[model samples]
Target: MTASYDAISPARQAISSARRVVVKIGSSALTSLERGIHSASLDSLADAVEARMRAGSDVVVVSSGAIGAGLAPLGLTRRPKDLATKQAAASVGQLALAHAWGTSFARYGRTVGQVLLSADDFARREHHRNAQRTLERLRSLGAVAVVNENDTVATEEIRFGDNDRLAALVAHLVGADALLLLSDVDGLYDGDPRKGDANLIPEVRSRADLEGVIAGTGGVLGTGGMASKLSAARLAADAGVPVLLAAASAADEALGSGRVGTAFAARPVRLSARKFWVRHAADARGSLRLDAGAVRAVARRSSLLAAGITSIHGRFYGGDVVSLVGPDDDVVARGVVEYDSTELTGMLGRSTHELPDDLRRPVVHADDLVVV
Candidate 1:
């Protein structure tokens, strides 16, 4: 039986109807000093993308190869350990990588736009909106966007671990219907593929099924591992975006001739963009101490009632972000506060019936809440 988009394996079916698609190419797939730009892979990928564009699809490429490609030219033997050296290599390599992509796509008369991003840019609300607008405009102009991490400036604390998560976030930001993660391996296996009796999963229905599955360590030249790819799949699935984990060398087979790898299914209902960011992107500024009653309400998917609020922590003004902590002190959700910290302190633990008429409403409404 063929799997439906919401069933066991749906990525193939999802791609057929996907209006906007995001393809993430790992570092291993795009670079090589001895073999430069992987000609067979590039040609296959370009051909698939060109065909998709001609069929009225919007395709965006999230690639990771700047530092990897630049390593040979800089006389470095391996990936750098220090941030400064890594940044220098990325800065030099980004130019060469962009040139190669431009030349490769030129054959199809396609224009490519380079967009380098840092995690901080997407953390703030205003900047996130602006980034979204810019990418949308580029797509509307019929140009392909080649996105990469701004490794030239990223510090350890500020850097996204790998492009996998970035690709998932990009898929959500651009409202992509599907995401394809192309790497050296074909897809997720039941165990290490080299082990005896190991099997191809072919489909993933839930996280529960992934238990005991030994994911492969990533290639030495690349930053992402199988675990990180699975993490990205979880994010995309939650956002209602199907994902495909396939081989870069098999781009044509995966995209056109037939399914060539594992596919992650999309969730049925997607979170709103703002709430999605609040749940997945925004780092909480502070936490609100909730009483037992508040915990129960939140567990039931209810809003934070003013009477159930016990105390507030940290300095935050009205409309600032805060986490909702249960009586156990674990954060259950994040939301924008309607009042400042000082105002909340005065109203905390007060019954709505006993409060002044103006303070009878919720401290944090359900609309503003994002369950983490």
Candidate 2:
């Protein structure tokens, strides 16, 4: 039977009927404020996931706790500020975190495969395809792919910054039907829930629904906050994958009952896989500033031409992703550049007919472009 991807399923149906799901557990959900990994919580999450798998749904977990889990072991009182310290903590904690997950899942006779990824894993086309294949293979072998960012090696510039966003991207990579963001908070609220007057938002149909919501940062042990989760939801929604945000404690209900959490409906129109990857997965190496006419042409879905190029911002090679900027300094589109920055620098402002055959090609082909 063919699957539907045109519109988001209703909130209850989205979760209850998902054939494949990506569940992200935040640091606060996996670790304690005072010490190391919270064994009970991890075990409960494993049980919940096992229940989903038993019901015939493929599951992938994007868990964040390496750094937080490593804190007490390393004798640190708070999250490290420097990159090296963070990397060290990640290296120390990843083993413990993976072991805990493996042990927890084993109780239900389920196997788990650890898949650590760096930004380049998704940014580059070849790596992205390989990661997808790996995940598929793991699923086929009846093992849950427990994914996490390769924080040990990722620099700040290349980091996803939070696993919430990473989980959303993983959902797209695996063609998941829905994404569940399991964090400390039960759901998004109109104001700070701690203030006693905020009301829980049951659903977010669009960006406008989040107008007056105030999102704060994660607790002492984590990096992301409510805003990051919302952004992640929006990204997944754009790819036609609905998202649910709820407390980690509600994992069972969120996956089975679907009565708890804030559901973000998927966008009515889904981007093509290639365009989705270009827009959300690939990282921009540089930017190309376009003239007014060129901007108009791009808006009309035309291939970018050298004649429209006004300036280049950074060094980039052909096949690398770059941003297309308009006079207003807003990024209008993103795509794989057909020529290197050096080559385009010398060819800018010249009409296609005026340049050599090789240089006459569109600066960025329409097939490879995605309007932001």
Candidate 3:
């Protein structure tokens, strides 16, 4: 199940035969305290990516090093803990990072298209489509898309580790065949890699493999820990995209040979992008508490009717995303509701035949629903 360059397994074959791939470079892997942006590593990575593209893989790179790069320039030796300082550093570092990527890729006579995104880009339908088109356009023109988070304009919330999750979203957005996550560490370990007894996990075939694994925190220079990488890997893998988690230093070996990292095999049943969005992207405004029968119906991909619902939680308008919760209080599915919570308050536990004509419609349609 490991993605070795020389391996011939399904996961390895998928990586080797992938036509479109998303490569994510973490901040700790791309920058350092003493040198700021790691030029040698960046140059080498650009070379590896160029070689990969020439080998017929369309590459999209999601990079995180802006804050790390900005630290040295601002005379800061460590990553700033505060949001304002982090944003200020990113404002300065993004320019240097974009320039570095442009220069490195230029050596191969390839142009780099800088794309800075926020969470909204993937959550909103219009923004997602526009970003998708932009990335596709860049790839069509033989330009490498250097995608990063737009931390400069962020206010109220600042999550430095979100780039890892963004990379997963990008993979599904572009219908990528594989996702390569390059960070500071080479691969996942059963325990802390800093310990002598910890063992490298070569493959993750299912959730069972990660049952007791502790996902450590982010590194000194970057925010995404092994847990974040694992979470991102699962997102792509569950959606039928193969994933490889490796170190930036091993970019050549990992990209070219498909060796030197843990491989997450793509699920046999691929989740459609729309369903994937519903499962992972759609924000639930409200919830419907369903009976056991409704849970079974939802799991079977049936339309959620009012008769099976016990109660509604929260206030949301019609057509908003709502969570379908079972009697156990666990969300069983998520979908667009057909009626407002206020309107549905009276409709609970009533069959369509018992309700008035105007209020007899299904609460949520099957097509808009996805079982969790």
Enumerate clash totals for all models, in the order shown.
Answer: 0, 0, 1
Better by lDDT, candidate 3 or 2: 2
Cα-based TM-score, every candidate:
0.90, 0.94, 0.94
Q: Per-residue error at 288 for model 3, in Å?
A: 2.0
- On residues 39-90, what C-alpha lDDT tens digit does candidate 1 reach at each position? 5566667788788778777998998888887787787778888899899889
- For candidate 2, lDDT tens digit of each residue in 165-242? 999999999999999999898888898877787888888888899998888876788889998998899899989998
Clashing pairs in 1: none
* Model 1 collision count: 0
User: How close to the true structure is residue 221 of candidate 3, measured as C-alpha lDDT?
Assistant: 81
Ranked by lDDT from best down, the candidates are: 2, 3, 1
TM-score, candidate 3, is: 0.94
